[model samples]
Target: MLVGYARVSTQEQETHAQTDALRNAGVGFIFSEKRSGGSMAKRPALEEMLTKIGAGDTVVVYKLDRIARSLKDLLIIIERIEAAGAEFRSLTELIDTRSPAGRMFFQIVGAFAEFERELIRERTRVGMAAAMRRGVKMGRPTAMSEAEEAEAMRLWFTGDYTKIALARRYGTHISSIKRAIKRYRERHQPSLLDAA
Candidate 1:
């Protein structure tokens, strides 16, 4: 059995080209999904295809990167396929992992993928650090202004509105309201240990 998997990152994208290629390659069962290949949990069709394969079966893809986000991820998926006693095949890369030469090519590709990811991560970290040193805010901005937060806390204490209602009114979340209240008490109120 030659089981195929095709994927695209977003709803606007289509997997038609990949599906056509896989079909032309004579793959009998092709699973397709329009999702970013970032997380394993998000690819249920990929997981199902792997789980359904058995000995003497082969897992096929139009391209290796279509199914894997990084080298570690690709290797992990191959490990799962191998554990199921199945072979791995990629059409564009001409990789058929049942053969020694094909395995070497796969390893070389995986190494380059891992190196590329590391370089990207290093660049992002350097950029963030540089921004921080220049006094630029690095993360998400606050959800509420000081006056609004104060009013929300006052309303909460006076039992005029529930946290959910206040969140809706302020266009924030219950979590933000709760965090504001907790911070306020921690600053002004004595702890039980201090009272003791």
Candidate 2:
């Protein structure tokens, strides 16, 4: 028996192409899902497929990355398959772990995939650091505008509106309302450094 698994990172992505490839490879049963390959815990379909595989069964995937993003994860999954008396095969990479050379090539491909991911992470860290050095803000923008914060602060001080009311009025959470007031206080209050 050939058991296939296909995956996409998000709901916006489709696994049609991968499933088609698996079917073309003579896989009669396939488990497909839209979920990140970043973690094995998040992929229930992959887990189900692994459990369904038995002796003399081959686990097939359209690509290696579709099954796992890191070499450690890839090796762990392969070990599980081997332990179940099953083999592994990848269509795009032409890797079939039924032979010594095939297993070696599979590991080599997994190593490259892990290396590429590390490179991407390193580049992203460098880019974010450079942007920060240039005084660019790196996180999500404030939910409330400066004018809105000022208005919230003024209303809060007036004692006419409660925190919940301010949140409802601003269409933001109570936490945002509290933060706005906190920012207002920080801006207006004289600090110890200023007193010195």
Candidate 3:
């Protein structure tokens, strides 16, 4: 049995190209998803397809990245397919994990992924270090000034108004009001508890 998997990262994207490719590859059953590749949890169809696939079956995908974005993720899925006594095939890359050559290619790809990750980490560290040397502040920009935050806390501590009412009065979101109050309480908490 040959089963197909097709994925599109966004709801607005079409899976037609991948589906058509899978059908052309002679896949009898197809599972498609319109979920991002960042999280496997969002792809229910892929999960169901994995559950249904078994030994002696072939799982076909249009592209390697269509199945998974990272090498580690690709390896995990490949391991699952191999453990199930099934084969994995990628139409675009012409990879067939049932063959020895294909397995070697997969290892090569995994090495590149690891190299790429290391490069990314190095680049990020260098960039952050440069930013620190230049005294460039990083992190969320304050939506409200310190004075506004203090005034919001003062109003809240007086117990004269509800959170929603305070938010409406100050023309700020209720969430902002709640966060301000939370931060204020955390900062003013007794030091005895901190020692404990």
- The candidate that achieves the highest lDDT relative to the unseen native structure: 2
- Could you tell me the TM-score of candidate 2? 0.77
Ten residues in a row with the worst lDDT in model 1? 138-147
lDDT tens digits by residue: candidate 2, 100-168: 999999999999988999999999999999999999998878788888888788889999999999999
* 163: Cα error in model 3, Å: 3.7
User: lDDT of candidate 1 vs native?
Assistant: 0.89
lDDT for 16 in candidate 2 is: 90
> Please, what is the TM-score per model?
0.71, 0.77, 0.67
Ranking, TM-score, top scorer first: 2, 1, 3
lDDT of 3: 0.85
- Please provide, for model 3 over 1-196, each residue's C-alpha lDDT reduced to its tens digit, 9 standing for 90 to 100: 9999999988557989999999998999899989898777788998898888998999999978788877777888888888888999889877888879998986686567567767987999999999989998787655568898898788888999899987887788898888888888889988886779
Whole-model Cα lDDT of every candidate shown, in order: 0.89, 0.92, 0.85
Residue 132 lDDT, candidate 2, scale 0-100? 100
| Model 1 lDDT tens row, 1-196 | 9999999988557888999999999999998888888898889899888889999999999988888988888999999999999999999988999988999899898788678878998999999999999999977676889888888888889988998998999999888888888877888898789999
